[model samples]
Target: MLQRKTTKLINKHLLMSLVVVAFASTSLELAYAQKNQTATKKKSSDISLTSDDKIFLELREASKNNEASKAKDLGQKLSNYDIADYVAYFQIKPRLFDKGGAPRAETMADDAVDQFLKKYDGTALADRLRNDWLLVLGKRKDWPTFDREYAQFVLDDDTQVKCYALQSRLTKGESVNVLAAEVKNILLDSRYFGDACPDLVNSIYKANGFSKHEVATFSRMAVENNFETLANRFDVPDPMADIVRSARKSPEVAFRDFDKKAWRTSKENTAAAWGSVGQYLAKKLDPNGLKAFKMQHELGHHHLLTPETQEWKVRAALREGDWRIVKETIDHMTPSVRKRDPAWTYWHARAQKELGDESLAKESLQALSDQYHFYGQLAREDLGMKIHVPKRVAADESLVKQASSNKAFARAVRFYDMGLRFEGNREWNWELRNLSDKQLIAVAEHAKRIGLYDRAVNTADRTKLEHDFSLRYPTPFKESLAPIAGSIGLDTNWAYGLIRQESRFIMNARSHVGASGLMQVMPATAKYVAKKIGMNSFKPSQLDDMKVNLTLGSNYLNMVLQDLDGSWALASAAYNAGPGRPKMWREKLPRVVEGAIFAETIPFNETRGYVKNVLANASYYTAMSSNKTPSLKQNLGTVSPKASVLSELP
Candidate 1:
């Protein structure tokens, strides 16, 4: 099973059956929209609709077509059209902006939106409207209004709004130095920058919020990360811009031409350039990545690189088995970058230990060992301790009752019923933001009761003081899966671990790449495995079948495991990154390295994380299932060349 990000929803008829809670008689408008959902569904032609249903459906179409007059006329025909807020929203949206994103002077959207916000304050749609209105205000440079609304922007998740928030600060005559650090963090990822973000960066640079060298590094970092729009808007020299372009289009050529063209600019900053090219090369798996990084190391500018490039340098050095370089590169990283993820903290400690700094290593490992994740378990092993589960905290009946009646949880269920998972998860997480450990466990229990296993596992996982491994690592299809795994000489715990990560036991889950079911197997991979197991008349569509999907998924996993000399870490990586990739990585190994080190140096971020999580998840499952000490170090074993490569495993 590879990556599957898309959620597969069942029939919409199921949605019609879901009981949406009515907002306590306070929302007479939305109540009308939901109250009739309990009625039996009939064919459109066979149905004799009520006057309200007819008016509401027409209002919906009118609003969709932006027939403002027709929608208003329809709205006037009914006092209770359930979801009246939506009708109001549709009417105001067209008025706020016509076909383009401009409000005509004749439109009265401003007053209408104010009324909607007042009526629906604290609701999800109200927050959404505020977000939309803030964008319009941002475009109009209405700083006072933007500032007021931005304060109530519950999510504040939009990059453009974030950019506008900064711009509003500047408009209020805030000191550039005061906002410089925030600006830098915002501009870190240019791809999320959107239209307003580039201008924000430009404004900061032009206002001297950032120095020339700092601007250069940020701009080049953006370009190297496949975002050229920021660099184009940046006021850099033509030569520097050209260098970013070359590096983007062709890293090898740019790396070669960089030295010759260094004097073209002020020659004050080559760190961004070298770092940019090296990152591009490193991503391509080219040997010149190390060569270019060595140049940055020689110039003493490694620390001047972007955080991503700094991480790549560390990964590149680790892959090369150069402990000194790994230590040095990690040392050059900023403190924030070094401490952001436990993986880095763990790797830094390992690097130091490799260089005979046990005192430094022990401190980092000791801090990291308290966690129970992949890196945490590895850290525990490094400190010579076995993996152990934290004591379980039992949920109470009172907490369960509170969770069952939770208004936010009810709304989340409604959204999930409508297959709007983004909105549902946002609502679910918002409620979780302030909940106590006890409340979280109760919420998870309630979620599990309603067949929301993904939410159940995720919520249970957030508990810090008390642990519940059964809730965290739920076994949805254990009855069917255990024997299937055993028949193929597979550890049922490993299957559960991989399945937990893949689809969270959602029977109908589908990924962005078309992988499906609990196994998250690709359609093509499903067919290949089907044929290998002599499955006649197997269609890709049948991947949704529980029994068939498990059979194929387990077989594929065992195939990779055998090919990888039974190394769980290697097989897990192969499963995620393809069996051939792990082989290639192993073949490049100067000598056999520790499994954890090999995993740490994995080039693909997603696959690297996948391997760690899958194996760690497997270890946890083992600890819960058997009377055994689940050791991540033992699970990982030693990473080495495959005993016998399966060229056709893919």
Candidate 2:
């Protein structure tokens, strides 16, 4: 019985030993697999191609054949590779297109359309192609083809309205009155083009007979366009002339009472407010006084409105016995304000101490124990005495030097102001090139002094070639942009043009509406795209990094291009407006035409001119940027009116 029991115990021990060995072996195998996986991941992440890679091999084959078609095919296949591949593809596409001619290129495009339509039917590309087809049909003046295609594709009301107008133009001789009514209907539709009502009204007058009301409307447009001579033709005093005079007398009150409605209803009031301020300042100060005050005020706004600024302001005010401004400044303090305004608290404590409020002053001083304010530490040390020394933040000397020499930076500021002016008035194609280099440089320096760094950088870059100094192109990232154009299938000249128009290639470029980075991406859009591309960890600050910004911007642009059916015109429009608006316009093509006619009839001057300017710019850019310089006929497409059309008409 004892021998049997001992045998049983030995068997149990053997089983336990086998279990431990098995666990150890399994863990070792798992570790080996994990290491192998890590190696594979690293290889995949490299993105750099070797000589033996399929794309490189295909490129080699295409090179030997001297067959442009084969080369083009290989190039397209390699487009999924890194930026190097994209550059190679871009270089090859033009060569292939040049060699094969339009027919061959068109065939390839058609094949691509077919393949993409079949594979990604519901995607942005499919919609884009459909829109392109519609545009082509419209350009060809093939209304039947356009109508047939328009039926297949979904279009937004705005596009529909435009389509209808085009159709009406085509069928004008058949029933002039009917077509005119159609145009008028489109003009009245708010969804199609609510902003262009005035233009539509003028069109209506021309189509029928010009009346006194129509002449008045045309004169108002002239006035809005800054054509004082033409505007003077409507000699009737502005209905709100008295209101404008009243507002001029009380400029501050006018500014305070300014709202969207008031500005829209009374141009005289707006002119009065803006002109009055200039006149008042002119009277109050010397010739240079207004300019100097503007510079000083802008600088003060930048440096004195921040929490740190507020702290400094309060301290300075307390010392100068100017409590009113200090109190007004600190009234709407945020948490960031409290944290950054240690100097403010310190000065507040001093004020209390001066008032013989020892207890409150002591409490304020004690509060600084855990904080790291500029004046907090000093306040703690000088709690019992009057705090007099002001801590000054040093300006970056290199940055200041660069800013001072940057002419492009100055131009950007001027252009920005010009844009604002253009927004208020309906001026068209006001080019920045008209300004002198000296003026641009001065503006750049002024922007820098006022903390408009992005504008300063833009202006500086634009004036770089003209200036002999290296200070204009001080940013290292500017040098890195050479490879960016080719990588994105853009010509260097065109890229420069676009950048000049966009952000002047300033990596830290930001729009007033919170668009950030070189391409001015909105935060939400950036985040969405980053995640879509598996860059889940992208931070908002990365948008300011040149390489990252270019990569993401190119990707976003590709997406937009795809969405807009490869029409750079529509893509540019979508970039300005949201993609949804453009998409809706495309979907409701007929309705959109009506809406556009309606928009033309709109009394709102701003939107009327905005659409026209954007369209005109897009047309110009498209013609200028195409591989071949498009003919005037090609540029304007079917919309090009006959030489005598306008003259022969009304």
Each candidate: what lDDT? 0.71, 0.39
Number of the top lDDT candidate:
1
What's the TM for model 2? 0.27
Q: How far is candidate 2 from the true structure (C-alpha RMSD, Å)?
A: 32.4
- What lDDT does candidate 2 reach at residue 311? 35
* Residue 618, model 1, lDDT: 87
Per-residue CA lDDT of candidate 1, range 1-650, in tens? 12322222223332111100111110011111231212111235434566776676677667656667877787777756655676677667655555544334442578888889999898777887888788778877788888889999897867788988999898778999878777655554556666677667678878988776776676676666656665666665223556667876888999889977665545346656677677777766566777778877777755458778888887777766777878888887766677666778888888899899999999999998888788888888888988887777877879989888998889777655544455466577768867888888888888888898877888888888876777888888788888889988998988888887666666766544566677768776777778988897899878878999999899888987887788898888766666666776777665677888788777776667667778888888888888988878878888765443445555
Q: Specify the highest-TM-score model's number.
A: 1
List runs of model 1 lying over 4 Å from the truth: 1-108, 237-241, 259-268, 302-304, 334-336, 641-646
lDDT of 2 by residue, 296-335 (tens): 2333322112222233333333323434434443443334
Residue 105, candidate 2: Cα error in Å is 72
Steric clash count of candidate 1: 3
